[model samples]
Target: MKAIILFGHGARDARWREPFDRLAELWRAQHADVPVELAFLEMMQPSLEEAVATLGAKGAKDITVVPVFFGQGGHLRNDFPVLLDACREKFSQITLSTTPAVGENVAVLQAIIDFGASAL
Candidate 1:
C-alpha cells in the first residue's frame, strides 16, 4: 500500500509538533486508504529512517514525503536530500519520493493569506 510521511524540522520543545500531529490526524481522517506518519529532521523522534521503517513494517511500499518547511532553505536543499538517500538505502524495498516545501505551494500560501485576512 501507499503511505505518506509529513516531514518537519523539529524543535527542542515537544509541543512544537502539535501541528504535525494534527496534520497526520487530519490525513488519517481524510485518506483512510493511505497511512500517514510525522517525521522530523532534528531534535525529535521518529526521524525519516524510523518513519520509513514503521511504514515498511506496516506493509507500505510506496511512500511520499511532504516537507512541512516554510521554504527550500539549506535544510531542505542539503540536509533533506542526504536524509532521504539514507532512508532509501536503508529501506530499499520502499519507493521513496518527495514534494517541495509546503510553504511554497499555492494552496498553502493561500491558506496563510486567508487566515491572516480573517484576523482583520
Candidate 2:
C-alpha cells in the first residue's frame, strides 16, 4: 500500500515533462509493486493532489513524495509545504510524507559530476 510521487517544478514548454514521464516509466519498470506518479508545481497535469488521489484510488495508504528539483529553492522550501498540507487535509485517510530535493542527495551530485567529467 505504498506509492511514490515524483514532484517537479513545471515549465511552460511541453517537452519539459519528457524526463518526468521517462522517470515514471523507469520506476514502473523497475518497481512493479509500488505505483508511481508524476506531479508538478505548475504548468502541468496531475497536480500533487491529483496524483495523491490516483494513488489513493489504487489503494495506497502510505505515499512518499520525492521532490525532483535540483535544489530546495523557493518553490520547494515555501510553496511545497502549503501544498502538502492541503493535500493532507483533503486526503485524510492517506499518509503523506516528503523528502528533500533530489539535488541534496550525494549520489545524484556525484552522477552530475561524473556526467560533466565524461563530457570532457
Candidate 3:
C-alpha cells in the first residue's frame, strides 16, 4: 500500500502540532485507503525515520513525504535531505520520496490568495 507523511519542522509549543494533527485527520477522512503519518524534523516525538518505519510496518511499500513548510528555506534545502537520506538508508524496503515545499505550488498559493480575499 502507498502512504503519505506530512512532514514539518517541530516547535517547542505543543499546540504547534495542532495543524499537523488536523492535516492527518483530514487525509484519513478523505483518503482512507492511503495511510498517513505526521513526522517532525526536531523537538517532536516521531522523527521522519520513525514515521517511515511505522508505515513500513503497516505494509506501505511506497511513501510520499509532503513538506508542509511555506518555503524552501534552509531547513528544507539543507537539513531535510540529510534526514530523508537517513530514512531511505534505514528503510531500504520502502520507496521514500518528497515533494517540494507547499509554497512552491501555484495552486496552493492561489488558495492562499482566495482565503485572504474571503477574509477581507
Candidate 4:
C-alpha cells in the first residue's frame, strides 16, 4: 500500500498544529484509500520516523512525504535531508521519498496571492 506524510515545521504553541490536523482530516476524507499521517520537525507528537512507523504498520511499502512549508528554507534545505536519511536507516524496508516544499509551486503561491488580494 501507499501512504503519505504531511510534514511541517512545528511551532511552540500547541494550537499551531490545528492546520496540520485539518490537512490530515481533509486528506483522509478525500483520499480514503491512501493512508495519511502528520509529522513535525519539532515540538509535536509524531516525528518523521514515528509517522513512517505508523504507515509501515499499516503495511505501506511506498511513502511519500509532502513538506507543507511556505518555502524551501533551511529547515527543508538543511534539516530535512538528515531527518529523511535517519528514517531511511531506521526503516530500510520502506521506500521513502519527499516532495518539494508546497511553497515552491507556482499555483500555491498564486493562491496565496489571490487570498491576499481578496483580503484587500
Candidate 5:
C-alpha cells in the first residue's frame, strides 16, 4: 500500500494541530483506501521521521510526502529534504516522493483572490 504523509510547519500553539489534523482527515476521507498521516517539522506529536516509520511499518512501500506550507521557504528547501533523507535511511525499502508546496498552485491564488474580494 502507498501512504500519503502531509507535512506541516508546527506551531507552539496547542490549537494549531486541530486544523492540520482536520485536513488530514479530510484527505484520508477522499482516499479511503490509502493511509494518510500528518507530521510536523517541530512542536508536534508525530515528527516526519516518526510518521514515515509508522507508515513503513504498516507496509507502505511507496510514500508521498506533501508539504502543506505556504511557499518554498526554508522548511521546504532545507528541512524537508533532511527529514526525507532520515526517512530513507530508516526505511530503506520504501520509495519516497516529495510533492511541491501547496501554495504554489493556481487554486491557492484563486482562494486568496476570493478572500480579498470578501474582505473588501
Candidate 6:
C-alpha cells in the first residue's frame, strides 16, 4: 500500500495540534483507501521517524511525505531534506517522495487574499 505522511513543524502551544489533527482527519476522509499519517518536526508527539515506522509496519512500501508548512524556509530547504535522507536509510524498503511545501502553491495565495478580505 501507499502512504502519505503529512509533516508539520510543531508548536509548543498545545492548541496548534488541534487544527493539524482536524486537517488530517479531513484528508483521511477524502482518501479513504490510502493511509495517511501526521508527524511533527519538533515539540510534538509522533515525530517523523515514528510516523514513517508506523507506515512501514502497516505494509506501506511506498510513502510520500508532504510538508504542511509555509515558505521554503530552513525546514524545507535544509532540515526536511536531511530528515528524508535519514528516513530513506532507515526504511530502505520503502520508496519515499517528498512533495513541495504547501505555501508555494497558487491556491495558498488565493486563500490568503480571502482571509485578508474577510478580516477587513
Q: Which stretches of candidate 5 lie over 4 Å from their true place?
A: none
RMSD of each: 0.6, 0.5, 0.9, 0.8, 1.2, 1.0
Name the lDDT value of residue 10 in candidate 6. 95
Instruction: Give a tens-digit lDDT track for model 4, residues 1-120.
Output: 999999999999999999999999999999999999999999887999999999999999999999999988899989999999999999999999999999899999999999999999
lDDT of 5 at 78: 87
* Ranking according to lDDT, highest score first: 2, 4, 1, 3, 6, 5
- Highest-scoring model, lDDT: 2
Steric clash pairs (candidate 5): none
Q: List lDDT for all candidates, in order.
A: 0.95, 0.96, 0.94, 0.96, 0.89, 0.91
**Residue 79 Cα positional deviation in candidate 2, in Å, after optimal superposition:** 0.4
Better of 1 and 5 by lDDT: 1
Any runs in candidate 2 off by more than 4 Å, and if so which? none
Query: In model 2, which residue pairs have backbone atoms overlapping below 3 Å?
Result: none
Poorest lDDT segment (10 consecutive residues) of candidate 3: 88-97
Per-model TM-score, in order, reads: 0.98, 0.98, 0.96, 0.96, 0.92, 0.94
Which scores greater on lDDT, model 1 or model 2? 2
In candidate 6, how many Å is residue 93 off? Answer: 0.5
Clashing pairs in 1: none
* Model 2 TM-score (2 dp): 0.98
**Looking at model 3, how many pairs of residues clash?**
0
Tens digits of lDDT, candidate 5, 1-120: 888998999999989889888988898889988898999999887998889889988999999998998889888898889888988988889999988898888898899899999998
Cα error, residue 3 of model 4, in Å, equals: 0.4
Could you give candidate 1's per-residue lDDT for residues 63-120 as a string of tens digits? 9999999989899999999999999998889999999899989999999999999999
Candidate 6 colliding pairs: none
Candidate 3, 47-117: lDDT as tens digits: 99999999999999999999999989899999999999998898989999889998899999999999999
